[model samples]
Target chain A: MTVQDVYLLSPEISLVGLALLVMAMDLFVKRKAVLFLMAVVGLALPVALSVMLWMDVQAEPGGRLVGVYGALTVDKFALFFKFLVLGSAALLLAASLDYAKRLTRLQGEFVGLILLSATGMTLLAAATELISIYVSLELTALPLIAMCAFLGSSRSGEAGLKFLILSGLSSALLLYGMTLVYGFTGSTYLTEIGEAMKNPLDPSVPFGGLVILVGVVLMVAGFGFKISSVPFQMWVPDVYQGAPTPVVAFLSVASKAAGFAVLLRVFYVAFPSLEMDWALLFAVLAAISMTFGNLVAMVQTNVKRLLGYSSIAHAGYLMVGLAAVASRIPNGGETSALGSLLFYLGAYTVTNLAAFFAIIGIANKIGGHKIDDFAGMAKRSPLLAAGLTVALVSLIGIPPTGLFIGKIFLFSAAVESDLAWLAVVGVVNSVVSAYYYLKVARLMYMAEPASDEETPASSISLRLALIVSALAVVAVGVAPRILTWATDAAASPLLP
Target chain B: MDLEKFLILSAVLFCIGIYGVLARRNAITVFMSLELMFTAVTLAAVAMSRYVASRQVLANPGDASEAVLQTLLTGQVFALFIIVVAAAEIALGLGIVIAFYRSRETVDISQANLMSR
Candidate 1:
């Protein structure tokens, strides 16, 4: 609204500008590749702006900058996600270049939509007000629903329809919850809600405790769909299987990360007074999600659907960290639990991106997403096969992989918070997940090729994306100090 | 007349909407159901705002009335946002339904199960 507010929102503004520029350039540019390249290069502006904001936060005494009348905050936490979302956008654009050729007409719109969604995601991370958070969430999801339908194929249309209906349903539930919270607190500001919730009982409202509890439960259900956790995870496999591979990759990583971002902010900032109640809720959800996702994933034949289930399982793992943070709040252990969650999100981003990039490369050549299609991939394209293998290993929590360190931190946090039973369930689920993840690896390495034709080589951009993400997985796995330190810094914003 | 009566009406509409969403086969019908849910939410928000405003006016008559009115507007503002967002959601939903019908020749969600195992 003011000059200073605009200054604080430079990164989001630049991202929107970049999205529009990509759309406009599509009209004049002869080659669609140029538009793709323009979008990719323009992502640097937001990344640079985020870095500047990061430095600004570091220099500030409290390491937080509230702007737009407390609707948005620029801190290490939001900056971390800005970098992650921007990085993922750049990588996805690079990986989608060859795939965009298949779309023929909507290549420019595809890139434009991705950037627009990234803009929503960055804003979602920074939004501190309830209304701002809800708007940013819709902004993030609407483009994605459109993109899911961009393929115009029957399956794509189905994916799009399902995504729209389910997303709308969740939004309605979320809005009802927000309205109830506002009714109870008489304010829409998260800080004010927190203040009001300290002693939620009031003589004016009968059954005040039960009303707030219902509101909180409904809100969690809405977020549960976003993160693709159990009971609300029915759409994940269907959407992932039917949507374009690149969109699935982006959705699996960036969408889930943004979901968690807002989840952390809303729960920690607005409803900490109800920590014990929600902690038990998340613990139960986490146990169910991990068990259900891993068990069902073992039966999936399609690689994308399998990964979809695996993502649900991963969401459950992250919820373990959430439960830990809640239970440990009184002991001042929330910081470590939250830091572990952030670190896990970062590690999962790179690892999952690596896996999807490998899938994109192979599916581009073979034109199938079946596990049978991946047979003998190791012989055809050693680099892609190895990249996927490493990623799957990381997903299984094997040593020298990023997710291994992530799981360690998360489980330790759970145990430290006296949720060792949840930690045990998480460990058992990891073991169960390895059955399917390793099955894919075995298919790639051990099985004979279904045909004698040599698979075509992957495009250069995809190759670069795979190598970068794969190397990042290993680098972060071996040297987790840098990421942990950054996550620790990001987690500080949540501390009172 | 009373806040509880309005809230009960809103809750009934919301339950009916949920039933329609879960049981309807047609995508368009399901979308209508979603809109019904949003409308219910909007009703609840407005009723709550009015209820809070009446309480404020009774508790403090004159000097604090302006501040109470401003606070009451929060719920109304939230309802406005829900309306706008619901409009956008329905527009997008209809578009996706049309697109689905074009390819599948059906708006029945059960028939759209092409990706299920």
Candidate 2:
């Protein structure tokens, strides 16, 4: 309501307005260039503004400005994720250009939804109260469902429907949990709930504390569905394979990253007192997700489905960091574990983007995404193959790759938290995951050129995307200290 | 009913909603199940607000006049948000279902499998 609050939330406000503006402009403009330009500008402006705010914040920390009854809080944590979300939108928009022209209809609306969803993600991260988080979460989810069917094709339509129904179910489950928490605590504000739970009403009858614990589990299950955690991850492969490549890329990175941002805030900020109750459940979920995803991925022939399972496995690895940080048998605190989660998310984002960039380039060229179809990828285009090599190596957590560094930090955190069993499970899963990721690499490198006619060459934009993402992966892998420091700084005072 | 009983009833309603959602194949039935879940949440919120009001009344015996206002406002707010979310969900959900029906001539979820590789 105040000027300070307006300043704090201007990035999100502008993003929403820009989304509407882009949608309106679509009605007037016929040129694809215009739509792309508008989207780029929309995403770029917010990212730049947020980055400037981040820098200014580092120079002189800003006061936490609450908007509308402590519903949303704009602080360092919010700004960090706002930058990341908007930056992701920019990258996704840039990556969408050629693919959108070829595959999808309603190009303008697709771009608009990207911006809108990023805005929603920003708010979801900033939200301090339960209702605001729920609203923002829906805002993020709605557009994502729409985007999955941007092609307006039957297959895409089915994917969209699947995502819509599954997402709605998850939202309802999460809301029910939130309602239970609110009922027990007499307030929807996380701070209030924490204060209320500082002294639990009763240890018996599954009273206030137990009800809240069940609520938290439901919330995790809901988010687990979004992040494609095992048992709740049935929709991922079908949706990813059915959707267009660019949309799949966007969903894999942006949606997953946003999910983590919210998860970190909820577990670290809102539910720190209840860490013990959630840790064991997450550890089990993590183990299942890693093992299940890797095993499923090994059998997948479709590139998108392979990546889908790989993403689920990646979620499991991230959950290892979550469980470690939230572990109750903690000797000291698990700030290092919290830092590892951030580090892994960053590494995963870059490596996954690189992999997708390569896949998109290949898909764009050959008009197919099956593993066997990539038999002569190295002979056809050495550059694209090289990019895939980097991405695949990183994905398999090979030495001198971003994922390798990420796994090291995560495992170290687990060791520090006395989660030796969980760490061992993660390592075993990582080793099993290598086989599937290597299969793609082997097909590209060792398989003979197919007898069929040559596929088309990679597009210039896609090639550029491949190069950019590959370099980023390698750069992060080589000089991980910069990312390490940032993650550590971001994760200060672990239990928010 | 007492606060505990009302809360238990809301929880039962929630479980019924879950069962319906899982067991039903019709899109409309699934939609109704979702609505049932929302209704359960509303009931829980209202009951909790009422309980808080009663506690406030007991704490400040002379200030029972504002208790009704507090409970009603909180419960109504919770209901209002839930309604908004439900409205948004229905708009999108039905849009997809109707669009699919136009193409496929069916509303059964089991028949909605066009995304297989």
Candidate 3:
């Protein structure tokens, strides 16, 4: 509402403007390459603005800024995700050039929708109130649903429809839960709800404790769908396999990251009073997701479907950090659980983007989704094959990869929080996951080509994206201090 | 009507909506059920807002009247947002369904198993 608030929201505003600009330009322009360049170039403004906001947050003594009547907050936490979302959008756009070109008539809309979704994601991280969070979440998802069906294939249609129905159902569940919390607390603000729940306004409101408990549980279920955790993960393989490869990559990383961003904010900010029970609940969900995702992934022949299952497994690993956050609440020492969660998300984003970009490259060339299609890939395109191999290795948590370091921090957080059993589950699941991931690597290196023809080379933009993401993965793996510091700063506002 | 009666009605509607979503085969029918669920949420939100308003009046008469109104308005605002979002969701849902129907000549979800393992 104030001038300063406008300044604080500049990053999101610029993204929206960019989306509208891209759509408007689509009508005037015929060249898809020009539009892609415009989108990629426009993304730089938001990244720069987010970094400025980071400086602003640091300048402030408390390391936080609340704006727009307390509906949005700008802190290291928000800034961290703003950078991640913007970075992912740029990378995805770069990787999607070829895919978008194939759509022909819908290329403009594809790029425009991605920008719109990225705007939603950036806002979702900054939202501090429940209403704002819900609105931003819907904004994040609707375009993605549209994008899921962009291919016009029967499979794409199925993916879009399934995503729509399940997402709608989850939104309803989440809304009902929010309504219950509002009804009981007389507020829609997360901090207000937290304060209200700390001491009941009126204890005679029927089954007060039970009602709040149910509300929290339903909200968890709603968010569970977003992050693709167990029991709500049925849509993952289907949607991932059927949606455009770039869109799947976007969903697997950015969408899940935004989901966790909001999840952490809501649970830590609104439901801290219920930490013990929710923490335990997340711990159980974490174990199930890892075990189920890894085991199911082992049998998948479709490379996309395999990544889908692997993403679910990664979600399980992330949930272990969530559970640790809960268990550590009582002792309240160093809240590394949340810091580790943020760090892991950052690392996973880079690593998964690398893997998905490689898939996009290979799929665009070979025009196949089966893992066997990747046999002899190294001979055809060494850069892509090596990039994917490194990415898959990172995913398996091997040394000198971003995910390896991420897993170390996550499991250590679990152990520090006295959830050693959860850490053990995570370790076992990671080992189990290595089997399928290595299988893909083996196909790329050791197996014979399914055909005599060499696979076509990837586009220059895609190769650039692959290399950048891969380098980031290795950089973060070798030297995690920078990201760790950022994650720590991001996590501080959420912890007490 | 009492608050409990309104809540009970909303709960019944919600359960029916859930049953429809789970049991319905047609895409359009499933979408209708999703709308039904949103309606249930709207009803509950309104009833809860009224209940909270009454409780506020009873707890502190005349002094905190503005606070009571503000609290009631928040719930109504939530319901309003839900309604708008539900409309958007259904629009997109039906569009996707139409697209699916065009490709497959059917809307029965049981038959839409092209991606199933």
Kindly list the per-residue Cα lDDT of model 3 for residues A1-496, writing each as its tens digit.
8998999999999999999999999999988888889999999999999988998888998888899978898889889999999999999999888778778799988989999999999999989887888899999999999989988889999999999999999998998888888888878888888898788546667666777887888888899999999999999999999999999999999999999999988887787876347667889999999999999999999999999999999999999999988777666754578899999999999999999999998887789899988998887788989999999999999999999999999999999887899999999999999999999999889988777775466789999999999999999999999689889888887643
Query: Per-prediction TM-score, chain A only?
Result: 0.98, 0.94, 0.98
Q: For each predicted model, how many residue pairs clash, with residues at least 3 apart or on different chains?
A: 0, 0, 0
RMSD to native, candidate 2:
2.8
Model 3 segments more than 4 A misplaced: B64-69
Residue A371 Cα positional deviation in candidate 1, in Å, after optimal superposition: 0.5
The stretch of ten residues in a row with the least summed lDDT in candidate 3 chain A is A200-209
What is the C-alpha local distance difference test score of each model? 0.90, 0.78, 0.89
lDDT of 1 by residue, A206-259 (tens): 447776777877888888888999889999999999999999999999999999
Per-residue accuracy of model 3 over B33-100 as CA lDDT, tens digit each: 99999999999899888887777677777765665667757778878898998899999998999989
Question: What's the TM for model 3?
Answer: 0.98
- Tell me which residue pairs clash in candidate 2: none
C-alpha TM-scores of all predictions: 0.97, 0.93, 0.98
- TM-score of model 1 (CA atoms): 0.97
Candidate number with the higher lDDT (1 or 2) = 1
Chain B TM-score list for all models? 0.93, 0.82, 0.92
